[model samples]
Target chain A: AQSVSQHNHHVILSEAASLELGCNYSYGGTVNLFWYVQYPGQHLQLLLKYFSGDPLVKGIKGFEAEFIKSKFSFNLRKPSVQWSDTAEYFCAVNRRTGFQKLVFGTGTRLLVSP
Target chain B: GAGVSQSPRYKVAKRGQDVALRCDPISGHVSLFWYQQALGQGPEFLTYFQNEAQLDKSGLPSDRFFAERPEGSVSTLKIQRTQQEDSAVYLCASSLDGGVSQPQHFGDGTRLSIL
Candidate 1:
């Protein structure tokens, strides 16, 4: 079975601090990676996705993620974070050839303090 | 609709009661999905539909959970004799197709609470 692991459960950072949320998956095949963000009382929104080609992908709201194939990791990062950036982040993976059933990781809750 | 829409944003039901959750996908979307998100956890796939056909339902926890996209555009997830463990936020997502590259559009989920 495929599973995603998010190393952080909770993170606290001051405004302007850099953010890095680690995500690792246990799949050996070609996979599609995604990062989703859920704001307080809001629906989950896609932050970015990686299919093929360049390993680095930029997403909305100045967010970006690097799909390191060797490490089996797709970590999300932002140079600076604001209080508005506080939200729950989820990492999801699915095989590139199947019905695209997403397997999501336990989410990381980030609190950006002003 | 501009985006995927789910009804009864909040639902509170007593144990052993049956509850039905509705999802309306974007117009012309060929794929629809249902997911369950427990408190403080990521969403988990429950079922998938392509048009009016349910292509995959392997993620459904048990026989108590049933879903139907009779016409393909509107879907319903029915939980029979709901238990406490059934409490979670049920989310609906849709994509242009079941293709791997298509990004899914999500709706504000229906938060189900079993009392």
Candidate 2:
């Protein structure tokens, strides 16, 4: 079975601090990678996605993720995070060839304290 | 208002009761999917449909859970004889096409609490 692993379960940082959440998947095929963010009371929103082409993909809200195929990693990163950026982030993936269901990793809860 | 919508933002039911959750995908979305998110966890795939055709249901936990998109638009997920373990947030997502490249947009999930 395909699985995703998120190395961090909780992270705390002061405002303006850098952010990096690690994500790795165990699938040996062409995969579509995504990062979704959920505010305290909001639905999951697409942050970034990588299908093909450039491995570096930029997303909304100053978020970007790099897909390192050799490492099987698609880590989310932000140069500087604001208090409002605190939320649960999820990394998901699916096979790139078909209409496949997304396999998500255990979310990482980040708290940005001002 | 063009995003996917889910009805009954919250629901509470007895252990043995039956419950239904509805999902209204974005207009003209050909692929609809259902997912279950436990507390403090990521959303897990439950099932998906490609224009009223059930393509994959392998993610469903058990036979008690059933989902349908009869008109290739609105979808419903029904759970019979619900158990306490069924408590979770049921999320619905839709994409313009069933192809692999399209990004799925999600709806505010229906939080189900079984007592």
Candidate 3:
């Protein structure tokens, strides 16, 4: 079975601190990468996604992710994070063809202190 | 437009009881999905439906789990003889289409607790 690996289980950061969450997948086939964020008591929301375009993809709230096919990684990054940015981030993937059932990593919990 | 809506934000059932959760996807969405998220774990795919057709049931953990989308809009996930391990949040997501390009939108999952 294909699986996603999120190396960072939990991360603590102060306001304005940089953020980077590592994500790697075991699937070698063509895949669609996505980042989803869930704030406290909120449903998961789309952060960014990588398809067939440029590797560096920007998403809402000043978040971005770079898709590296050779490495089978799509890592999420932010130049500066705020207290409001504290949430659980998930890395997901699905095949480019056929059923679009997402395979998700365990998730990285980000805590930003002001 | 309203996002996906799930009924019974929280549910509690006895170990041998049965429970049902509901999901109403965004209007006109062509795809609906069910996922189970255990504590401290990411959501895992349980089933997928395209319109009224159930195209994939491979992810379902067991035959005790059943899902249906009779009219192709609303979906229901039911589990029989719930066990302690069945305690988790049940999430429902929908996409405009069942294609790779469309991102799935999730609802506030139904947190189920089996006693």
Candidate 4:
């Protein structure tokens, strides 16, 4: 079955720490990738998405993700994380055709301590 | 409303009871989706609707689960004879179209607890 995987279940970091949350998908066809963030008591929000273009895409709040097709990976990254960045992050993908339903990975919980 | 909206932010029901969860997508959104999110896990797709048509129900786990988008604007998910394993947060999302690239807007979700 097709699935998305996030190797890190939980991560802790101090303020200003660089961050990288790994995401890998098991699909062989063309796909669109996305990163979503959910703060405490909030709904999921789109951080960024990669359809087709430059492999690296930047999103709001200084977040970015690189889509490495050869590796079937689209890892999220941030140069410096703030305490306010603590939240759950999910990586998702969908086929480039047919129903556009997303298949999401088990999310990574990030705690950025001050 | 400006975003996708789901009703009954929380619901508690005994096992075997029937429950209905409602969702109101953005006025102009052409695509709607339903997902079930278990604790400590990401949301899993349950169903999809394009306007008034039910394009896909493949993600539904059992025959007891039913979803409808009768008029194309509002949608509902009905679970008959719910089981303890049915307890999860039900999320609703909508996008401008069924396009491969449209970003979906999600609601806060309705947390369902089956006792």
Candidate 5:
């Protein structure tokens, strides 16, 4: 069975601080990676996705992620964070075959204090 | 509609009762999916439907959990003999195509509470 693991459970940072959320998955085959964000009382929204091609993928709201095949990791990063970026972030993985079902990791709660 | 819509923004059901949650996907969406989100956790896939056919239902926890997209447009998730553990937000999402590259649009979801 495929599973996603998010190393950080909660992260607290001041405004303008650098952000990095670690995500690793347990799958040997081709996979699709995604990062989704859920604001307070809002629905889940896609932040970025990596299907094929470049390992570095840029997403909305100045967010980006790097897919490292060697490490089996797709880590979410932001050069500088804002207070508005406070939300729960989830990392998901979908296998290339076998139904393409998305397996989600336990979310990471980010609190950006101004 | 601009985005996916779910009905009964909030639902409170007694234990052992039955509840039906509705999801209205965006117009012309070819794929629909249902997910269950517990508090402080990521959304878990429940099922997926392509058009009127249910392509995948392996995520459903048990036989008590049922979902249908009769016309391939509107979908419903029905829980029979609901338990306290069944209390969670039910989310619906739709995509333009069922392909791997297309992103999914999610609804605000129906928060179900079993009291």
Candidate 6:
């Protein structure tokens, strides 16, 4: 079955720390990738998406992700994270077939301590 | 009105009772979807609708689950004889079309607890 995976289940970092959250999908076809964030008591929000072209996609609040086709990965990154950046991050993928429904990974919870 | 909205942000129901969850997609969006999120797990697709047409119900886990999008707009997901395992957050999302690249706008979701 098609599925997305996140390597980290939980992560902790101090303020201004560099961040990298890994994501990989198991599909052998063209796909669309996305990163979503959910803060405490808030709904999921789109942080960024990559459809095609430029593999390095930048999104809201200084977050970015790179789509590496060969590795079937779209890892999210941020040079520096703030305490406000603490949240649960999810990686999702839509195979280029059927109705294009998304398959999401089990999210990664990030805690940024001051 | 500006984004997807779900009704009854939280619900508590006894096992075997029927429950209906509502979803109002963004205006002009042609695609609507339903997903179930268990604790500590990703949201799993339940169903999809294009306008008033039900394009895909493959993701639905059992016959007890039903969803409809009447008038090509508002949608509802009804679960019959809810089970304890049915307790989860039900999310509704909408997009411009069922295209491969359209981004889905999600609602806050309704957290359901089946006792």
The digit string of per-residue lDDT tens for model 2 on A1-109 reads: 6789999999999999999999999997789999999999999998999988999999999999999999999999999999999999999999988795899999999
Q: In lDDT terms, how accurate is model 2?
A: 0.95
Q: Among these predicted structures, which one has the highest DockQ?
A: 3
Report every candidate's CA lDDT: 0.95, 0.95, 0.96, 0.96, 0.93, 0.94
Candidate 4 lDDT by residue in tens digits, A1-114: 579999999999999999999999999899999999999999999999999999999999999999999999999999999999999999999999887899999999999999
iRMS per model, in Å, is 0.8, 0.9, 0.6, 0.6, 1.7, 1.1
Per-model TM values vs. the true structure = 0.98, 0.98, 0.99, 0.98, 0.97, 0.98
> lDDT score, residue B84, model 5?
98
The runs of at least 3 residues in candidate 4 whose Cα sits more than 4 Å from the true structure, single-residue gaps closed, are none
Candidate 3 — which residues are off by over 4 angstroms? none
lDDT of 2 by residue, B11-103 (tens): 999999999999999999999999999987899999999999999998899999999999999999999999999999999999999888888
DockQ values of all predictions: 0.85, 0.84, 0.90, 0.88, 0.65, 0.81
In the range B55-104, model 5's lDDT, one tens digit per residue, is 98988998999999999899999999999999999999999877877788
lDDT by residue for model 6 (A17-108), tens = 99999999998778889999999988888899998899999999999999999999999999999999999999999877667688999999
Report model 5's interface C-alpha RMSD after superposition on the true interface residues.
1.7
Which segments of model 1 are wrong by more than 4 Å? none
The CAPRI quality class of candidate 5 comes to medium
- The ten-residue window of minimal lDDT in model 6 chain B covers B97-106
Alpha-carbon DockQ of candidate 3: 0.90
lDDT of 3 by residue, B1-115 (tens): 6999999999999999999999999999999999999999999999999999999999899989999999999999999999999999999999999888998999999999999
Sort all candidates by TM-score, best to worst.
3, 4, 1, 2, 6, 5
| Superposed Cα deviation of residue B83, candidate 6 (Å) | 0.3
Instruction: Report, for all candidates in order, the number of backbone clashes.
Output: 0, 0, 0, 0, 0, 0
* Least accurate 10 contiguous residues by lDDT in model 4 chain A: A93-102
For every candidate, give the share of true A-B contacts it also has: 0.79, 0.81, 0.85, 0.83, 0.60, 0.79
Q: Each prediction's Cα RMSD? A: 0.8, 0.9, 0.7, 0.8, 1.1, 1.0
TM-score of chain B of 4: 0.98
DockQ of 2: 0.84
Model 3 TM: 0.99
